[model samples]
Target chain A: MRKWILLLAVFLAACTTKPSFTSENVYVGTDGVSLAFTKNSPPAEVFENSIFPVGIEIWNKGAYNVEEGYALVNLDQDYMEPGEFTGSTSIFPSDASKLDFQLMGKSEISQQGDRDTIGLTVLTKPIDILSEKHTSTVSVMACYRYQTFASPNVCIDTDPFGIRENKKSCTVSDIPLTGGQGAPVAVTKVEVKMLPSKSQDKVVSQFRIYVKNMGNGQVVDASKVADACSSEGLTKSDINSVSVSAQLSNGIVLDCIPKREGNGGLEGYLRLKGEDYVLCNYEEGVPMELGTFKTTLNIALDYGYMHSISKDVTIRKSAVI
Target chain B: MEQKRVFLGVLVIVSLLIIGCSGSKGNQPTAVEFRTGSSGLDVTFPSGTPQQIFENDIDVRIPIQVENKGAFPQFDELSEFTGFLWVGGYDPNILQASFEQGDIRKQLDPEELEGRSSFNQQGGVVLESLILSVGDLPLGTAVYEPTLIFYLTYLYKSIASVPVCIDPEPRSINVKDKVCSLTDFRKIYSVAPQGGPVGITNVEEIITSNQIIFKFDLQNFGTGQVIARDLVSSNPNEGFDWRDLNRVQIEDVRLGDRSVDKCKPDLGEEVELFQGIGHFQCTLSVASIASAQAYTTPLTVTLTYGYAQSQFRNIKILEAIEI
Candidate 1:
């Protein structure tokens, strides 16, 4: 009896022990839709005949079912539709067309499994897209129903697209279209005149330089010019002593008054007595290019001032009348 | 009367038997036999015997292994044992020499010796002798192995004659004086900023106000103690100033800053300064001073320090600052 009781107790203890069960489930689904484009031909040179043949593939990586979908290859607009399409075509628009683009066909990729892949090809003739060089996007969109056991089916839509481009228009051109000439300067004209002053034995010849629109661009203030005689070099005192005179080309001797009532170059008048003006003597002898007697007439203009044209005139002793 | 005589005779016989048994007990071998050599407990020297000098101690390892060869299980609980080293035939006079005179003659007293140095019982019995002074032993003298005897107690009975060999022979050393003297001054001139001008002075002040430091390297040139008094500077006029004649000094100086007095050299224990090279700096403070008067005198510093009864000199002169 005791043997039987022991066996029973052992059996009871074994039966009272609880058993545990464990299980694991793996699930994989698509997250969203994606679109990619492959070029069929090499890019065209800047001013050449080139056609861009592109193929686009849209992938839907989700556990949902897509009901209706469309892909539009429109310029400056969105492409969304549902159907089957083999390919599409577009002509690169001109300026008269105002940078417009068109879509031809549509294709549909039925949601068969958790992931569905759709492919579309776009063969576009070489268009002069460089006329309005800017960015354009080709988009693909689809609407699908998302279903799960824990929740009712939910409908979601998405549009994914890739860009087709003209390589020449996409990159900055190295050749500058304008303004390659050196720094521009503004000036109406420059005229030099010699007028006689008082004395006869020593003709007081006055050299005048007419500066028009003096303080215009780039060529502004004048640098100091050295005289043939002065050994110490030109000082501020020498620069200040020189006088500038302004006159009209029509011989209307206007008042030699400064425009701003200052000693500036803008419509300024300056005078030098014949004795005060020393003619420079060249030891190597003056070249024919330089007149026999040379005197520097320095006029200070505002910063960045330039003269488009300049002329020089000289007056000397007359043989006889 | 005859019966009484027979009884007495029997008693005499019993008494003789008892006496005989007591006599046999005395004759039984009191000497206990223990396994020796590698077969039993063994002593291993990590450094394979050491040749040490006077007052030098080395670690001696004695590995003990106990075997119960008896039929009945025997629990030998050796709580404590007495081990003794018998260094026989050593000249007592040599063991009595003074250490100061370079004599190895000195007796290492048991009371003054550390117990651990000579006795170990917890894990395999091992004992190392304390620092011994083998007084004035001739060179190439052989130090014999001392016999080690361990008194073991088992089952409350004391047993002697557990013999152990001193695996390797003890160290024998000849005493001699160690003399050290400064041989050369390796002047690792501080880089441009730190190095002083070798010939020219005054053109430009060294950016860093580092002194001309001289590394006085002393070599054990002679046989002596290299006594503290031996370190004497030969150039007394030079700035070879040492705070303590016994210890070397490191001098550090910065431009415009006062020279820091003798910096102590870091010497670790067990590392005897047999060849000591001290760095002494001679600062060019005069050149660093802004005023012309400061450099007018032109400072020339020479250092002299005593080293092994000889004088070492390090001379440095500060020239004028050019600008």
Candidate 2:
């Protein structure tokens, strides 16, 4: 019974013990195993806010009989956490998806003696975090053909890589206030031409009126009556009582005739007494010319008391000149 | 008997070994667990007539009551707690005290609370002073509806922690009976330039020089009265310069009732001009000859006054224009 027990213990110990597999006196053929990251399959660049997917493939070259061993890849310690392989599957799984990887294809390679070159491809689905920076590593492992030996874990020393960048939106603040309606006013164009009346020694000029809506709204029942006038060239004492007729270019007769005044200047008020008289000043008048007696008409609107409109007009000399 | 003794000895040794090994692996306090309790406290300000407080009146008595519904015991000594009072996001530059132990309780010295004001004469009332204390508190004692925060120094084993905090709940306070007086007379407030020429010709530079001046229509607005004096001017990139410009007495210059002697009167009653209109004319100097870039300067005018010398107070108004 004692002998049987000792034998059982010896068997258990032998089963647990692993044979020594050292790299000594082992002749390596010219076809040495070489590992590389696959082409057209580089790791993805991750933005600060988004995620990236990566895959990696490895190539092994060895002439002599080699064991079917697995590869272990180690990401740079500073940038990424250590990554491990999934069970028998070729893909690698990462605990943190928010990481940037350097290489995409197979991060690990297995040693199969039947083929001159062995390859592996690993896919790492990682998310790129905008809040922080990250990096990853790649490595390979091979197993010997004999059960008694295995190859050392091989890893390529490469710089860590980051995911693609995500752009930040530009923003601004504190915009100023603007936009409001200004004052209300109006403008009128007057043309004066000196004509030889039937009984006058000097030529008398007839004043033609052209009223334009220059305020913010339309004008209705506008009465263009002269309040005062200059006696510099006229001979009438009731110049203040002198009434003259006027009309708009739209063929509408003005409500009241132009009244004369003794102020030696043509002074009048156009009573634009209506609510819908909405019209902008700049679009109200057409450019006209009368031969050389330059003058401007100033019209005041009731709404904006301080604002007024002015238009340039010309008077022609009689044929006597 | 010898064989029995040997067997007993072996058994004893085996039992001792097993006991020693198990003892080595006994329960240990390896990982520490930290527990925290959260609570809040509400503070109130007494309502009454507006108090008139001057710079000379430094120490002001503010009544504050602290109620704790948390599991922690109320601090026996008020000295263990720290408090702060904020008015309109500013320190009112006055010391706060309460009645405690048959004496006026002052947490901070008067020097620490001096020389702090809202700068802008905009008034603010003190809602409450947040008080915080750290000590062994019961589980629910420190946790209340309104959290109470104060400066506290506590020790857990060899580690000591001090936390400063404020109550996050919203509160309101009455305007205390106090008045602030100004020693210097500063800028007079007025509206910005308006009704000026729309189109300026011969544009050597877009001169804001041709300005249309209008008096502060006393009849329409009011008798422009001033109390405190604070003249503030700001540039584009630079900040505002708040300084005491000059001191002048208030002379009533209204057209109808109060007009200065030798001043002309027009339109019904005599219009009074408060101060020099020329003084308020801000010139917009052209900085660049080619670029149309212009800078806007804003002037903030603050007045300090009262019904009498004994009841002085201050107020502020702002005016800005593109220069």
DockQ of 1: 0.00
Q: Please give, for residues A230-287, the per-residue lDDT of candidate 2 as tens digits.
A: 1122223311111223322212233333323343322333334331121112112221
lDDT tens readout by residue for model 2, B85-188: 21111011111222332222223322221211223111112233322211221111111111111111110000001111111110213433222211121112
**What is the per-residue lDDT of model 1 for residues A1-321, given as tens digits with 9 covering 90 to 100?**
999999999999999986874221111221323334434311221211222332344444322233322333332221112122334322222211111111111111322223333333323223333342322343322211111110101100000011110001011111111211111111112222332223321222222232222122112122322120112334433332222332221121233343333444334422222222212111122122111121212222221111121111111122224
Write candidate 1's Cα lDDT for B1-323 as tens digits. Answer: 99999999999999999999999999975543221111111223334333333312222222222221211111232322111221111122233212223332212222222121112212233333322343322211112121212111111111111111110101213343223111131212221111100111111122232332322222222121122222221211111223323232221222223432222242111112423322322323224344322111212221111122111111111111112
Q: What is the C-alpha RMSD of each candidate to the true structure, in Å?
A: 41.5, 43.3
After TM-score superposition, the amount by which residue B208's alpha carbon in candidate 2 deviates from its true location, in angstroms, is: 85
Worst 10 residues of 1 chain A by lDDT: A151-160
State the lDDT at B105 in candidate 1: 20
| DockQ of all models, two decimals each | 0.00, 0.00
